[model samples]
Target chain A: MDYFFIIDFVQSLADGLLFGTTYALIGIGFTLIFGVMRKLNLAYGAAALAGTYVGLGLFLTFNAPPFVVFLASAIGAGLIGLVVYYCCFRFTPEAHPMASLLASVGMLLFLEEMMTHVSHGMPHPYPSVLSGATLELGDIWIRGDLLFVFGICVVAMALLFWLLYRTPLGLATRAVSQQPRAAQLCGIDSARVNALTFVIAGVLGGTAGAMTAAAVGILSPIIATGLTVKGLIVVVIGGLGSIPGAIIGGLLVGAAENIFLLLRGVTERDIYVMLLLFLFLTLRPGGLFGSAATRD
Target chain B: MKLKSLITAGMISASALALSSAAFAADKTVRIVGFGASSGVVGIFGQNSGAAMSAAFEKINAEGGITLADGSKAMIETEYYDDRCNAEEGISVLRRIASTDALVAIGPTCSNVAEPLFGILQAKVDDAGDTGLQFPVFTDVAIKGGLAGISEWVFRNTPSEAKMYDDLFAWIRETYPDAKTIYGGVEEDFAHSRFTWYSVMKTAAEAHGFELVGEAQWLLNDTNFSNQARGMRRAEPDVVAISAHPFTSCGMLREMARQKIQPKVLVGLTSSSSLETLSGCANEAQGIIIPTSFAPVNDEAKAAAEAVAAKGGALDLHSAAAWENAMILRDVINAAGIEGTPDTLEADRRKIRDGLAALTTAHGLLGENKRMPDGEAVKPYVFVHAQGNAWEVVHNPGS
Candidate 1:
């Protein structure tokens, strides 16, 4: 390859890594819920976008800053996560996993339609915290917004790690994830753990959504389904319930997508990404960091 | 005394008959159905167009409505339905409207929906074996090329991108002779943007002596444009064209700015000449030119814009077509000389269709709209550029 082509490839890699932060955030939300209940909350992406819309509404109404909007989005998403858990999972008999899955899908459509109704399907500009600011490293350009999103993702991942490894709630969550019956016998309320897990995942999803909108500088109702599909792909390739796997899978997918986009143009880019997902499913069913024990 | 009583009863009966006939004549209303994505993604198009159509109808009714063949004025009534920008919903709405007393139907804001929706319409005007609905469809928004040729019953009051781009390139060649090379990317998933870019825009640019740069096609709703931006920056063309919706357009433009892909000229899809694009990326979209059929620069367009605004709609090119279409409907109805009655609804619809087919031109907000042989309009358009959070008319090739 020519030097210019090499430089372009490196730039693509860097940009993909930055973009991967969002996928990781969304994947983490799915992995967390799956880790707790062994059921996928398909409405997670919609709830995340709904949270962002809520943040947008607050920002428009009160002229709040970007940070305030992001905070509100996280909190709003957490509440929506609780609602989804209650409606889709809490009362449903776990005998059929499809029931909860179908319920979450219904919830996803409801949230998307609700947003479309409220926003009138018009795309609104999300406040870019550091728009038009770029850091140049020789031949490569780094977007300031993407950098900020990357930083936020790192901080969020660290906080999640700290919460999971250095807190009593973490202990309860792990116990429930490992053996719900045994944990319940030991007087640990699995239901509370699951609900709390959903709340945490929801907050992550909301922050992801806000960060994504900020990165793009525009938010619309159309992002919900696309994000959900990406999140699902990330989770499956990262190993269904493995947190670290989700992060790795997200980066891998992002990098692969950019590389494929460079090679085959946009029309064929997603086909390659989907093929990669299929390959991973067929060859490495346990994912990069996951083992059979991690599988639901 | 009995003969006098019989005369009194006869007189009373005659008065009752006259009053009933007068009431029937007063209640005469001409119905038109409008359907589009009024509630989902891209609902703004439907909402705006529906509002503009309503405003036009309101003005028409206030100005004595439409005079039918019998010399009686019949008020125009519109029923708007939400198709949600989906093909299934588009067909559903078409079926429902076809079963009504509507003289004509308008809408379906999306090209994807329009593609299939137009297919189910009667192709040759009266193909008995086809079993297609013989409803006259006057599309306002769906702007994919050649859709008007799908059925004789279908007509579109949308800007022809081929003509618009051809004129735009010719104007660009004259205005900026030094800008010879063009690098661009299009949102491939969107049918309108993709088809326009592949069929009209590239060909027009090439015909106008502009060389194209690297292969770059971006997906619709793509948030990241790093690879494409890098490619464009390397090509270092004089102009960069982007065919995308406002949301993706803003994203790509922002990325281009970040990557410092500064070209001498920036051109965008005609669909991007809207308040949404301005609000989404005001700084990034600066100096981006687009050809638009509707701008508030002209007095008539300004008045129509204000009217639409008053009715809670923004008058962009797509929505502005609705206003012109409503007036065109009135003109066609009058020209067709249809009797406005429920019993004659089918015949009246055929007359309206034939009237629309016979129309060679209609009055547009800007000027006279030229109708193609295939029931499409060649609307007068002006080149506009984004300047500090607003679209300003930069060039007017007067009609």
Candidate 2:
């Protein structure tokens, strides 16, 4: 291979790894919701973008700092998550999983259309905390904003890990995910736990969305559906309800996309990624960390 | 008493007849329909065109609308439908409009929808057996090079991508003789962006003695363009071209800036010459050149721009075409000399189509636009460059 090819490969890998953090964040959101509710929240991506838009509005209105904007986006997205649970999950018949899934899809369209109406489908420039800062390591140059996103992703995941494994809420969440009826019989409020799970996932998704916009340097209504699809792919590949699986799946998919992009062109990149998903589906069916049997 | 009652009844009957005739006269208004994605992700295109057409119709009606063959003046009225840039919705809206008494129709903003939608129209002028809809469609925004040729009943006032790029590259070759190497990327998922990049822009670049640097194609709506930018940076070309919608263009340009992939000359797709690009990536898009058919530099264009702005729309190349199309429809309505009546709707539509076919030239904001035999418009265009949050006119080849 030529030196240029090697350089391109290295660069793609590095960029993909950083971008994978975002995919992991989104995948974790899907996994968390699935773990507790056993249903896909297709509107999670749209809700994330809606939160980012709210943060952007705050930034535009009050000239808030980047950190504050991210904080506002997370909090706003958490509130939207509660609303989604109320509308799409809380009152729906739990016997049919498709009901909640379709309801989430409708919510997705509703939020996307609402954003389009409010913003007139215009893209806004997202503020960056580390704009124009680059770190060079020999021949490889890393973007500062991407590094910041990666760090944020790591800290967020650690916090989530602690919340899920080391806290009283974590124990309750695990108990509810394992046996909701038993948890309720044990005097635990399963509904409250489910709602809290959604709020947590929403916070992560919102942070992911804000970071993604900052990374891309623009935010628009167009990003919603694409992110949802990506998050779905990541969730499926990482296993339905496995947290660590989401991270690994996200990284694997991200690296694979960039590798394919370098080898083939962009037209064939998605084809390969989909092919990988197909392979995982046909051969494994349960994903990287999932068991042989599928969950409800 | 019987004679007095008969006289009262006679006066009442005469007054009722007069009022009925006056109401019939008042209802003889010319109606047109507009349909496009006025409410979705890419809603701005449809919204802008609809606003511009509405503004043009307002102006025309204010000055006394089209004069019919019987010397009766009719006011122009428009009904707009939101198709949401979907092909199925486009068909549904077209079918709905076909059942109405609309004289002509405009829009379905996306080229993908327009391609299939135009296919369902009557291809031959008078083929009765085909049974395709025979309504006259004057598209404004869908600019996929040869879609207007799909149907004889269909017409487009969009910019000719072939002519625009050919002229642009020729000008670039003359203006920048030292810019020999070209590197660019295109949003491959979009039909217009992909087709124009491969068929017109790249071919024009090579024909003008510029060499391609590396393979640069990215998916539409892709936020991360690091790999693409890094590849281009390796080539270090003098001229970089980006053929994409405003959103993708903004993302790519921002990535390029982040990667420090500076080219001496930056050329962009026609669709990127809008306020959206400036607002999205003003710093990164600085000095990017694009060929466009509309700019508010001239008096006529300025007036139309102001009118569109008043209706809450920004006048870009695509939207501005709607203004010219409305004027064209007015001219056709006058030249065809059709009586604006519901009973003669089909005949009026046919006459308008024929009138458009026979029209060789129409007034454009930049200059007189020449229409091809294939129902496409060849309007005068100027090259503009992004400079500090605005598109400054760099060259007017028309002059």
What does DockQ give for each predicted structure?
0.77, 0.78
Interface RMSD of each: 1.3, 1.0
Candidate 1 lDDT tens digits, B1-399: 999999999999999999987776667799987899888778889999999999999999989889889887789999799988899989998999999899899897999999999999988976778888898999999998889899999999999899999989999989898999998788888999899889989999999999998646777668787787778888999988898998888888988887778888899998899988887788899999999999987798888999999999999999999999999999999888999889899999999999889989999998999988899999999999999988999999884
TM-score of 1: 0.96
Q: What is the DockQ of candidate 1?
A: 0.77
lDDT of 1 at A24: 92
Best by TM-score: 1
Which parts of model 1 are misplaced by more than 4 Å?
A294-296, B1-9, B127-129
Q: After superposition, how far is residue B264 of candidate 1 from its true place, in Å?
A: 1.7
DockQ leader: 2
User: Clashes in model 2: which pairs?
Assistant: none
| Alpha-carbon shift of residue B375 in model 1 (angstroms) | 0.9
True-vs-predicted CA distance for residue B9, candidate 1, Å: 4.7
Candidate 2 docks at the CAPRI level of medium
Candidate 1 docking class: medium
